[model samples]
Target: MDESSVRKMSPRRAAELLSKTPGEELSLQAWEGLREVCVSGMQDERLSADERIGWAAAGALVVDRMRDHSECADRRVAMASEARLRAYVITRFGREDDSSLRDLSLLIRRVVDAVGAESWVVADSADGWQRMTRHEMLELRRIKNLVTPFKSILPLLSPTDPLRDKIKEWVDIIPLLP
Candidate 1:
């Protein structure tokens, strides 16, 4: 599909297309379309919260797939995708709520693992454990703070949750103090 065709699609329809399309044939156009749909869905006031969350989650998954396939070849695109995922979490769940904290921690850790510090340094010249963008620093702090509350309840979280593994990696890379 072309950019124009994808842009005209509704969020639900875009997500449908994304889900239906074979992974090998998934084009940049389709990805952009889904991203646009998510962006527009978040901005639309008429959509229900559940609908918006669905779109946002779909968008994040698309980015995650992109990262896995592309191997962070395009640093700018990777960074933008991660940022959009974070924005979706913030927009959907708010910044400081329990849900937001948990979800945002997951999102941040996903970026750290998927994109890696090398990609981030290449993309923004953010040295590992030294100079980071304010946003990156904030995300690290948020992940730490959020994970603290879940340590005792960790068994309740799904075993498949990446947080169980990625939190240790985040701690090793992200400086404890900004």
Candidate 2:
């Protein structure tokens, strides 16, 4: 959606748009609707974008995890899920501004949707990743940066191409590997 459309949205409306069609373009209209409501409840101006995106990302992550665990099917669940998704984005990126948060959330959601798989299915960090502190994210980023390129590992992992098949697969939590 364009800037004008974005300017007119409510958060609830934005959430519905995402749920109805998960991979829509970067609809600035939708982000504004949600951010308008969410940003006001926050504190630091510097963190506002981070908070918004963090809420959305964390909420989305939690919601995706709850798909089979929770039975709620109402709009309420959607609202809560959006909140969680925003939280995750904040936690990951350390920002909490309206525009930054919503932009990151939409971008992440779109990327996940485009791949036609849950985000976890694509790049789930190890079990400890969810609990990572700000220091940890920075450390991990640095560690990743310092690593030298490898011509190959013993055996390069065959990346799972999600689009080649239509069957939805579930992660077997017990196995520690999906």
Candidate 3:
């Protein structure tokens, strides 16, 4: 889809466009469009959390598909995409029906894998982890202590859940980050 076309896209349309469009074919404008759509979708209370996550996952896949491609070489943008994906997984996870739990698990895996050596800035609050903007979270870290959001998600997963192991592995790796 073109930039203007994507800008006008609804969550469902954006998801469908992202799913079918190859990463290499996506212009930077398209990337921005996906980001815009994902952000707006998150704020749209009319949509269920599961639906928001579905749209977020679709946007995240662009980065995953272009991981080694030059189009995704912009680290700042990639990190933002990763943060958006992580925010959805951390905040909306387990809030939906059990049928979608598996989907969330897969999205979590993808988000974690996409994170690799990147440092994620997130804030925890009574309103939940998704309430803060990335800039706000970054500012708070400059002025106060913060915790890795992944560690808090462990208690939400069952011990027998396969996703628990992946999350545990991710949590174990966090402290090792500089």
Candidate 4:
């Protein structure tokens, strides 16, 4: 479909398109609508688990497209998409099948890219907080909030798994933040 048509599409229709369409095929406006659908879908308690997974998958696609078109995509949209996708995966970690595990790994990598070495660098030291702007502190807090849920999911992963280690690292550092 054309950009104009996608812009005019309803949320339900946009979600349908999201499930079936590639992110590169849709305009950013369409992605906005898709993002709306995903955020709501993930939050809606009445939706079946499978349905939420579908929304999470679509959100992942949006993040992937944003990564590919980093220059063209809005940073806000990419960051929000990554945040939502990561939350969904981490919340549902133990329940996911093998394929979702693969998706989770990719999502983790994207998050690492988004947050960069900030996770390692902060350590929530007094000096780190002194050096950062208010905006930077809030962004780290946002990331901390996102990963805090991993504390519950951590036990589900094997001790030897690198993802488990990453989650442990995040859960460990976040509490040190003010």
lDDT of each: 0.52, 0.36, 0.54, 0.60
Q: Where does the lowest 10-residue lDDT sum fall in candidate 1?
A: 145-154
Please list the residue runs of candidate 4 whose C-alpha ends up more than 4 Å from where it truly belongs after superposition.
1-16, 19-33, 62-77, 93-102, 124-131, 135-139, 142-146, 158-162
Q: Pick the candidate with the highest TM-score.
A: 4
User: In candidate 4, what are the lDDT values of residues 37-154, reduced to their tens digit?
Assistant: 5656656677776666655665566555655553553354466456556655566633433546235565556556666565667574424664778877676665665555566666
Compared with the true structure, the alpha-carbon lDDT of candidate 1 equals: 0.52
Residue 167: error of model 4 in Å?
1.2
Model 2: CA > 4 A from native: 24-139, 142-178
For residue 7, give model 1's deviation from the true position in Å.
7.1
Candidate 2 TM-score versus the reference? 0.22
Ranking by TM-score: 4, 3, 1, 2
Tens-digit lDDT track of model 2 for 24-142: 33343343344444433233355555444433433353344333233433333333344444433444444333554434334334333433444244335435654778765543333
User: Which pairs of residues have clashing backbones in candidate 3?
Assistant: none
RMSD of each: 9.3, 17.4, 9.1, 5.2
lDDT of 3 by residue, 19-58 (tens): 7777677666566666666666665678887666765665
User: Could you give candidate 1's per-residue lDDT for residues 6-36 as a string of tens digits?
Assistant: 5566656766776665544666556656566
Per-residue lDDT for 109 in model 1? 53
Return the lDDT, model 4, position 112.
Answer: 64
Q: In candidate 1, residue 95 scores what lDDT?
A: 49
Q: In candidate 4, what residue range of length 10 has the lowest lDDT sum? A: 93-102
User: Against the hidden reference, what TM-scores do the models get?
Assistant: 0.49, 0.22, 0.52, 0.59
